[model samples]
Target: MKSIKSAGVIGAGVIGSGWIARLILNGIDVCVFDPSKDAPKSVEKVINNAERAYKNLLRSPLPKKGVLSFLDTVSEVAKSSEIIIEAVPERLSAKQSVYKEIELNASNELIITSSTSGILPSDLQSEMKNPERLTVAHPFNPVYLLPLVEVVGGSKTSQKVIDETCSIFSNIGMFPLYIKKEIPAFIADRLLESVWREALWLVNDDIATTEEIDDAIRYGFGLRWAQMGLFETYRLAGGEAGMRHFISQFGPCLEWPWTHLMDVPEFTEELVDKVSNQSDDQSGKHSIDELMQKRDDNLVDFLKVLKENRWGAGNTLKEFDDSLGNSRIDFSELDVSKPLKTFSTHIPKDWADYNGHMTEARYLDCFSEATTELMAIIGADEEYIANIGSYFTVETHIRHLDEVLIGEGIYSKTQVIYGENKKLHLFHWLHHNDGRLLATAEHMLIHVDLKTRGASMPGDSVIEKMERIYSAHKNLPKPEGLSRAVGDKV
Candidate 1:
């Protein structure tokens, strides 16, 4: 619930637009200033990409988006915003001038953050009148999905500014790694620079093509790096003895010239042509937008799998998801006497086929979520399940009546058929936003012991809640497709 009142973004290129999208999506109004004619288009594109990924990634309700306004000048943007983000070009003079303008129009209370990739925060803040409020909150490309942000404070910056920046970033679902000592290219980029330098050498020397180098990372160490990271990964690789033993085994290899560490390669036109052509050959078929879509889809699936296991980035997403759920409408507000409005969402692009129609499996996915929400209504939340037990779906019957397209808003209202003893039978009616019945799902679930994996008696408290709902629903007419088997007429 803690968030800033408003934010301002300067230079709506890739990074600036990304900040705008992330800020606005988290419900902070934004004033933007970008002199480029294409700034508006670029901002909307990033927002579109963010929205598409969010729909597939988070299961909870999203906060209402904040208002976005484009101001005529950088001074106007700074004057209107509580926080100012400078994401202009990397030139020192360009950044200093922007900071100077921001300081002139804004109060000393307004915090200023830079999205610089390699510039030191000290240099970034040196030109500002109130440099104490300056810090570097550098983020990776595709900022919405990737959670890591480097929060670096300059020598003149206040501890308050740094702390507040971290809090603001964390609220917007970012893991702000505080850099205690100001350094050029913070942390992640320093590591990335090493890899990039080596990759360039490999390409320049004809050791590997762009595709080959990409394949090695994507198919090999990249997978390990995503979950465990370097030192921890190597520690595991050390067999039973761990890090010390690993060093004993592989320390000698450091002396060998396996990489082109700091031996800088000449960036001749020939080298540039080679790298560019190779990259083109590798991914030339797909447009920039297509490449972005693929990257987002892959990341969403990875994060979803990690979430199920409660590991790595999954934990961060789970925390954000819980926060969203906490901010949502309470389940008790619903009338237990009627079919409950259990689940609702616009179908994400990832859920659709090439034709843009939602696939068959996603139908079951929607129903599963509806069933989960119903369980939550009847005292089967995570805490309850951990202490006691919960219901498990044993059977399902789904009738896909009408086709639904990607981006189409849909919802399900679930009715309790039988909510007593070990059995919990339910029926869900899925409807499009236009009032057409898109589908219906009938499910039967069993309450079970987590320890034994066998059927168990329902807890008295849960049974009491279920009994009340069942009593209220018992008088309703039976659903049309209830108990119907496949190939049987409804």
Candidate 2:
């Protein structure tokens, strides 16, 4: 899978933000555009989500970091991007209009994928100038964490487009399922719509409350669906007779009136109110955001279990770990110091070693985590690093000055020694829960080009931010570690 040098996202809605998170987490450089007044808010929400994803990935292993940027127009992003993901609203005319503008600005080689639901690729391509270049790549919500993406091609879509789309999805750690023929709602959504119709009918007839229906699925079928999909479930249902026998018995339901697809629900005031009241009762007192968070939490827990077993999409974790390997960095002594800012991280039980002290590796991990926070304070937060491709970790020299037992938190004081060009030198002093200096680690970081894997100059904006901090510390006493530089200070 080739790395996406630059990608463009054409919307900033929830799904758009989700696409942004997925691209950014996978080490791609993405530029996003949306015409709404709340575009910035949308980007911020995605960044927060990306941060949460980053934390989760680190809980297991470090994930590839991607750069993210926002543009004012579709044409602006299209002009420079290698790939374009159209996530504008689901309206055909809106998507077609955006496509026309993108075609005018983008290169012929740029692959364009849409996140449209139930929109046939053939119909969507009919509206485009170069129809062969576009395909529909629909992804589920919370796209950064989830692995499934349905890749569907149109009549005019070239084989090359399909192959390239598959490659791009894989690069971003997604499971791309290609549909050989176009079908409305594709595969998964069609099945979901069938079930949804039945659910509405059940509520309309008051046979079961909305929550009961949901419970039936979540506590029953949903559990099975998580590991084995529909066909496999039905195979088991056949009791060793297999799908043919299972179909023979269930096929008679085709003539039943139990399903309500033929008639649209009246959606009358009474029906709407009934469904609404039942939904509210089913959800209890949880707010919409609360429900979303709950769903995310559950998915995270489930994915972690899969990750531990290396099952299903969780196998992607092994790929992620393979990419991480046994990388380590060490930087022993450096120059002088500024007043140290106190930073603390609680030592989790997992960090405890067989000897009952914090594991040496975890000491390094916590110190690295501290470095991330320091980078954030120095203006190297998610968005900035996303754009500039410059991160601070170079080398660290960690000394186990004292033992840290379980249930204890360690604090660190970071003092900047000096910084020049694209490098920063900092000193760290680790302390125990009661505030005694435990160890010290010196860090020498050279800003890097994430795409090229080489040292590069820090962005001017980032350097300016760093200079301001340096100026503020000019009058403060130099840190103890910098005692040698006291007489020869710059």
Candidate 3:
């Protein structure tokens, strides 16, 4: 499938705004339109969300950011976008009217998709000028981070559209579940709705408070679900007997009165209040942003571990590996005169010293982080390291150039000092927001066997990577701070 160059998001509600953030952060140019006067504000909120998501993504490898535009009309966005996503409301008429406008102005080649929650694509496609191009691309909330998207195509939708949409979602780091036949609520949500019904019954009958019910799941099954889905977990539970055993043992519960599957609990104001209070109590003191950050932090760390094992959802590493196959280390060619990627980071409270300047240990840590980022660029990520059971980083020397205060913006730059088989020496400088070089660190790294924890010959693939960059920058002068070398010659 061809890469999506640009996308358009229609509507600025939570879902649409999330789509905007996700698209832009994935480096796809996005144009958004919503008639509401608050549309620009909504776009800004999305951009802000993207920025936060971008930071979270940095904990792993992610695509670069894309250009984002806020358009005044739906037609304007459609005119410029290769893929147009309609996130207008769940109302049938409102969505149909928006599709009408889209059909009038959109290019025939553009893919038009809806983010409708329950509305079937077949129903929406009935009025479309080109029903084959219309499909449902249902996504979870805060779409920038979550990795699941359900792609439901209508009766008239073409195979080409379905395949293309699947590829697009996969490229953007989301798992796409293609629905061969359009169904209400799609797959996951339908399963979730069943649980939701049971949950409501439990709460309505006072068998469990909302908080207690959530705890029962969050503290128990949620952990398993995070790593593997229900089927896999149940398969494990069955042990050597496998899924059939587990199912046979529990399948009889389906007929039990414990679940009021057909009952729809009344959405009364009192119930809402009770649920709200329970949710608030469950959340404790976390603000929305705080909760978002917590989720991001966990996802980042989780993905890092997945990347290590190359397990499920570790597809991000595979994507990274593919990119690194063509990965060019251009740092030597780039003027190390300036920071290549600059982002403000306040000195963490833990990094402070007795003199109130940043601690010596942290100075080394900051430069170490910069070097790790450089290694990431050159393909030293977890999977690569795990596969070979080898990693780089032999020695380091840090010199404090100037004092750094806690909570001040700290910047960093990596300069290539030397490169060879299984080894690359680098000099990294930590700078204050005021442009002062607070400290500099020089490091010598050797590829070592992770299993034995001993120095080893660099792998051929790693050596080739190093040779290419070293040959290119052969004549360049050594970086500062490397003039003073440490260690006894081996």
Candidate 4:
């Protein structure tokens, strides 16, 4: 499949704007078409919000953001795009008209997709000149952060279209789930609809409030479902017997009429009031904007934990991080005799504690990032650690010299104090942008073979590079606190 460098988005509502943000953040220029007068501002707002969340969510360096153009017509977007995603309302006539306009202007090779949550791809492609080029690429909300995108093809759609769409989505850090058979609502939404239906019934019957229902999920299976889907989770619940035992135990529930799956509760005023009042009582203190920020913060924290475990969505995030390419420093141009300026960043608001200064733990985090950058300089990057060997910090001594307020700029200068085949000793001085020394960390790292999980010597190239750095700094005067014990200075 041809690489996509540019994309087009129709309708600047929530989903469409999110797609625009995701594409732009991944370095794909976006051309957007929406009839709404506030389209440009709306899209910009979503992009800004997405950018904020990504700074906390992503640790790897990102490509330069892509350019965004607000166009007057769909034909203009179609003419310029390799892939066009139509995210207008779900009405058939409205979407068909969009396809007509795009088909009239776009090339036959241009891949066209619809963001309809449940509409059939076949129906959406009916009026198109080249229906085979169209498919359904449905994505979840907050599209910039969530990775799931359902790729479904119509009856007339070619396999090439599905494969290429999946490829493009994957390239942009999405986990594209291909639905073999084109079905309404695809997979996730159908499952979600069932739960939604049950929740409504529970509220309608006064058995549970909306808040209670949400709590039931969020505090329980919601956690499990994030990492493991229903079947696997149930399989474990079945104990040693696996899926068969699970099916036997839970199969009878299907016919028990325990859930109102076949019917939706009436949307009467009373029902609406009950649901709304309950929801408000549960979380009405926060405004929509505040809630959104909280949601993003919580997601980042949860994803970070999953990242450490390398499970589920975390694996997808890790893959995306690896694809971002290394940010290794080119040491050949630097004066290795002086401390290498390896890391620099501004403190974020979330890093502050009740005292308004950066939290104590964040000091170690800053030092750790500096150490990682130093490793990158010595030829130990993500790929190197994955394929060859890697250095693991076995010990660290940190002396806090000062406090840093939120939004203050800071940097770390590192020196290689000692080096050997399997051992590396380093020191990092953390300083505010104004040259005030804030902290210092001395780290001892040991090379280890990831496969064997045992100590191992690094490659000859790495050893040579370390030696060069160590030689350059050997004659330099050591800092005062270099080997001081943790207790009193005496």
Candidates in order have lDDT scores of 0.89, 0.75, 0.75, 0.88
**For model 2, which pairs clash?**
67-386, 331-396
lDDT of 1 by residue, 262-333 (tens): 787999999999999999999999999999989998998898888889988888889888787655345567
Where does candidate 3 clash, by residue pair?
A: 389-450
Q: Against the hidden reference, what TM-scores do the models get?
A: 0.83, 0.67, 0.78, 0.81
Top lDDT hit:
1
Off by over 4 Å in 4: 1-3, 268-283, 325-353, 381-458, 463-490
Query: For this target, which candidate reaches the highest TM-score against the unseen true structure?
Result: 1
Predicted candidate 1, C-alpha RMSD: 3.8
Q: Return the TM-score for candidate 3, rounded to 2 decimals.
A: 0.78
Ranking by lDDT: 1, 4, 2, 3
Q: Which stretches of candidate 2 lie over 4 Å from their true place?
A: 57-64, 248-257, 324-490
**lDDT score of model 1?**
0.89
lDDT tens per residue, model 4, 176-203: 9999897889999999999999998999
Q: Where does candidate 1 have its weakest 10-residue lDDT segment?
A: 325-334
What is the descending TM-score order?
1, 4, 3, 2
Better of 1 and 3 by TM-score: 1
